[model samples]
Target: KKLDAKVKLWHHNSQGLFDYSTKDFQEYTLKWRGDAFLTKSNNRIQNQPSLPKTPIAKLKANDLALYPGHLFASLCQDLWLVARSFTNGYRLAPGDIVRLGAQAFKVKQICTDKPTNKGFSLTDLLVFQEPSGETSQVHSLPCRVCLSESYSSQNPLISPCNCKGSMKYIHLKCLQQSIKSRVHSTDYSLAFMFKNLSCELCSKQYSSKFYLNGELKDLLEIKNLPQPYVVLESLSCKEQGLYIASFCTKSILSLGRSHQSEVLIKDPSVSRNHAKLVYKGQGIYLKDNKSKYGTTILVKRPISLKENPHLEFQSENSTIQFKASGLVNLLPSCLRQPVAKGPKSPSLPLFPVNKGICLSTDDLDFLVREAQGELLNTSLSFCQDSIQNFEA
Candidate 1:
């Protein structure tokens, strides 16, 4: 009869229970049985699956009624309380201020552990206590680099990286000088400055820029020589840091894994002379040199089918091809509006009805004319800011 009742229960909840695997289903059944036993006896049974250490732990047998309405109604109060607790709870996040009596702390980092199948997770917080009334006036610690206690508002001491102990604190100027000594070159005209700007001990990369006395400052100062410069940040785990290559009008900057190349990538996939960046007519263009893993760019906007019927682009490991049929126009009439006469607004490539077209990585030369400025503007801005600081 008990087996028959269990079978009936399984059949009744089959729609909702079917998603669970055999193991999960068995565990859930065990949990339900354990919960029922605990509710009746108020004691844990051997080898019985435990209930969640939540308010629902004391769930009565009536709460698991066969009918949905009865079950929901019986469990409503506990569930509502749980929901309310979660909604009203405050979670500690990075940059949050936590108070402990008279002392205050600033949360620096929050590390969370992956949740278990039993719905158990652990979180750890790294925080530093803020200086209080009398402690704020003290400045006895010396800079790690210069070993001087002379700290001013302009050249204040800071602990930016994850390095602890005596190596933790250093004057901003001393730190900058130390970094400058390790720089590949001082000239910013047409050179690459590639150095791992990370703490050697902690293996933590220093912030590219930081704030000092409410003024923003660049960690690595680079003099601005001219415009039309390209900064390539290495994504390889072995090689890191910015590779700045400035270009003159009609000048070419070569990139490859070989040291002979102007911008060395140091990756196996890159050919000896993988690609070239040509600067001409107020813009920079990339030309691939028949590389093993051909050069590719991110497609920010849709390509026009009217201009190129056959389109090819790389997505991860696969090369995708899109060939448009001349039979019908997929675009609406509103999108097919004529270009305006005034100053050219940044618009998507017009996809007018035309014969079938084909596009390859070689045919994306139009991107250099249109999207290069927008793409490089952010890096250029950072470089420009560093230049200003260098000049000052």
Candidate 2:
């Protein structure tokens, strides 16, 4: 083909080494070999000739627009430009967080005025910067109780209650300390001690964060139906021995001096039918039979713990065999180890030397106090001297 006019082939340096200050065209011969571009130049185009030999397309710097932190759709306002960029390999989708300079913005939504080729639309993207600064994000939220950053050193904040926003974030340690303070307070309610901790806002019990560990979870979950059992200690009966009685389901146990009673109390002080230990479901109830000396549930408080934190046993008649139902919630981590239920023989001992349900110091304290009064502040720390003094 013969040339019609003077042709000026301009190929920009792909490596960006040689700087071109002006559009002043230099003399160069352009040739085509089966759609491959052949540009003959020296000291101008340093790399390979990537430009197409065909004159049907041309590359112009003005054809490209670079906009940061701004929507490309709004800047161009033309569906063709947006579609052109999409064909040129630029991904713009909803919920994708794009970065511009030091700020981050998330794409909220995408809408288009009209459909384009192949069911694709030139989208009008909507993006909003995510919450930043020293208060809005999680890094800025501080523990209200400790007055320090909650996640500075990997200390997680728990929002178990109804508190919202910044007030909701609180360190687990701080929350535990606050609960301990309330437990030790003079006006602390004993009823609330067994129940869940109430939130300061709604005054309703917290759904989560009820227990730091699985103590509460284990107490609430009753695995197998427990066989009712009772241990009697410190009774002024004739023998003054630790007695264990495993009764049948829904059966009534009679505690009296008469031999007809299931549990024989050979003492003159005890009436013919002193008290009845009624077993129903998973609970054991004590009903006084209107005797002269009323029935009282005796519980021995755990004052001093042994060298091992898990092993605790105090000698003498101070120990009380609390019924399984009332004492399950007062377990001091001993019940954490699953215990297998033995046979349903009434002759079986409740807590024998070899196979016995060992009670912790905290379990004993709570059991004793709960039996003595209706309302008593409960503490899991039975080893502490502040709780009570033992006979030594």
Candidate 3:
């Protein structure tokens, strides 16, 4: 009788726990490293003024946080609002306790071998376990996810398809919804962490902006700003407006792509015209309010694959059609083209010839010619956004 057959372990730190607790923490207030940053963020907090200075204990459990939904827990002080620069901020020591919604982890070890002027970054590998006495994260089968290495024959994948080169496999369901199969064999996953994500529609970046709720905690990455994560949901319309997430650097936090869905981090600063949009908790949001000439559709919450948005996203077999109505005449015959973020040509080598080797100019020129071919050896493909005239 294994008392904990269905144990769920989340390998996260204090920030994850704080984010998962947004609902109750909404009223809590936050302050940025600089007062101007505060003014900017407060303006973006959407539908709210300053964050209420409240206590965590008074909040309900449901408001704490959930991995799979937009409804999360937040807190006062807005620590994460400014916790940027993973190379600095927040020093963790052994036996330190950290919380992640419904679960708390302790620092077992800090690999402090690397030396930096910032006194060894806080980005240390943290180990945690279930206080229930069930299992530790290191030894658990479900919790362990490792990167692909040279002879990983024993690595089990969610599907027959193997992982992309140099990528480690993490449980899809750990932070975001898991894909039953990796259809195209992608190099990145929703489970992995990212630093920058641009809107596929407008090529605009999703930078740190207003948080849906007030909460903050020092994070490992980025000093003096929130340890933010970008969220993209398979949402249905209803929750309107651009679903904006606030964090410094506006880099992508995570990306999730399954059979019929894909989620990404956004900066929410793109133009609102003639573009396809996706947001957190929202599945696929399309807007025709731009009168077909230049339409702007915003995705607010999760929607179904059968819905209008996923039809374009989940064309497992083919491309989906875009149906424009009242504004069709205002749009172009073929305005809804996807972005062209095709396979980029390989970059040239940094040191064409070893700098210290004392090579002649002739040798350098030869190396340059060879590198040119590498740069030209790529093709055009869909990146994400494709802006143009449209059809009604």
Candidate 4:
């Protein structure tokens, strides 16, 4: 076979890794946030079943909305940030913190660009770096996806990207760090507007951050025709930049950071025995991990999670229900302890949990006040003491 000088075989996906041949090059798809993409002129719409519009009251900072892929896309953005690196090889999981440059930025989107014969590309990545480097051509999709997968260990000298092999490449996160402090340094648009729109299905509300984007605009907004059973959206922006990660009828992104966990829904009837949830960044996977079927998870509205840190997770049918907000943002980390490879970090006192522990909420509150500015987990010790004392 002849090769074009302009053609270069660059990236490969390791998903079906055991075969080694799984590295075949193909175009990855990255959709925009508000605009899901549609390639077929005959069919370009997204359809989701209705969800309850009622927002849950009194949700804790960590309480989450349970839904399929909802967690990985939103709450677990950080986790996806960590895991995204595995798109190459290294697998990541919850509770792992990636250390890199001294700054942080939001993951604006993940996308796969239009394909080329030489090889396919994933493009248009977003992040806010400190000092303030932000976006770069090298920082686009596939590159950023890989960089966000691993944690930053103090062991320097080795570059943060950690990628190796013949198809050697760059780290999008590193590229982001390199572009510090430029005016409007971010490649993502500074503006966002999600205040007024209802999910095409239940008309459920979602936050602005979790805005939907897909190519099937007509079918989604047709107002009368039977919408397609499945609608897909990618991470796109107002200017029409789409990232490669895919979202569908059962999937939606969650909105901010908090104590909630991302929710997942799976119907065996829809697919075969295989069902899994992946956070592209932090690399946490919650599927049939180590639990039996029918496990239940409860989450409140407006749940938030740090960009995906690995955490324990399980899901079932309607048993995994969440409010409208669940789909918009990844919820926060749990109030209770989480499993991690690192040393045990402290936990904060969950005022709501005090009652069961025999500690008064007010009393726990007072202790927390005293511990202000201390390590996050240190304050939790005070509450534990109060409980141990009361129980005695």
Candidate maximizing TM-score: 1
Model 3: how far is 319 from its true place, Å?
1.5
How does candidate 4 score on lDDT? 0.22
Ranking by TM-score: 1, 2, 4, 3
Q: Which candidate is the best by lDDT?
A: 1
Which of 1 and 4 is ahead in TM-score? 1
Q: Which portions of model 2 show Cα errors greater than 4 Å?
A: 1-226, 234-238, 298-392
Q: How would you encode candidate 1's per-residue C-alpha lDDT over 147-250 as one tens digit per residue?
A: 88888877777776667777778887887787666435323222333344566667666666566555555565644434435444333345444445555332
Error of 3 at 342 (Å): 42
2 or 4, greater by TM-score = 2
lDDT of 1 at 305: 27
Q: What is the lDDT of residue 51 in candidate 4?
A: 18
Q: Which regions of candidate 4 are displaced past 4 Å? A: 1-32, 35-289, 294-297, 301-306, 309-392
lDDT of 2 by residue, 344-366 (tens): 11111111111011211124344
Higher-scoring candidate on lDDT, 2 or 3:
2
lDDT, candidate 4, 1-392, per-residue tens: 11001111213212211111233432222212111111111111111122112211111223321122222122220111221212232221111121111111122222222222222122112221112121112222233334433333221112222244421233423323332211111121112212123222233332212111211111011111111111112122321221122222223222111112122112221112222333333222223221222111122111122222222221111011112222343435563222212112123333222111211112434444433422233445544553454445
lDDT of 3 at 129: 18
TM value for model 3: 0.15
lDDT at 230, model 2 = 43
- TM-scores for every predicted model: 0.39, 0.21, 0.15, 0.15
Q: Clash number for model 3? A: 74
Give the worst 10-residue stretch by lDDT in candidate 1: 76-85
Cand. 1 Cα-lDDT: 0.36
TM-score of 2: 0.21
- Per-model lDDT: 0.36, 0.30, 0.21, 0.22
Candidate 1 C-alpha error for residue 300, in Å: 4.1
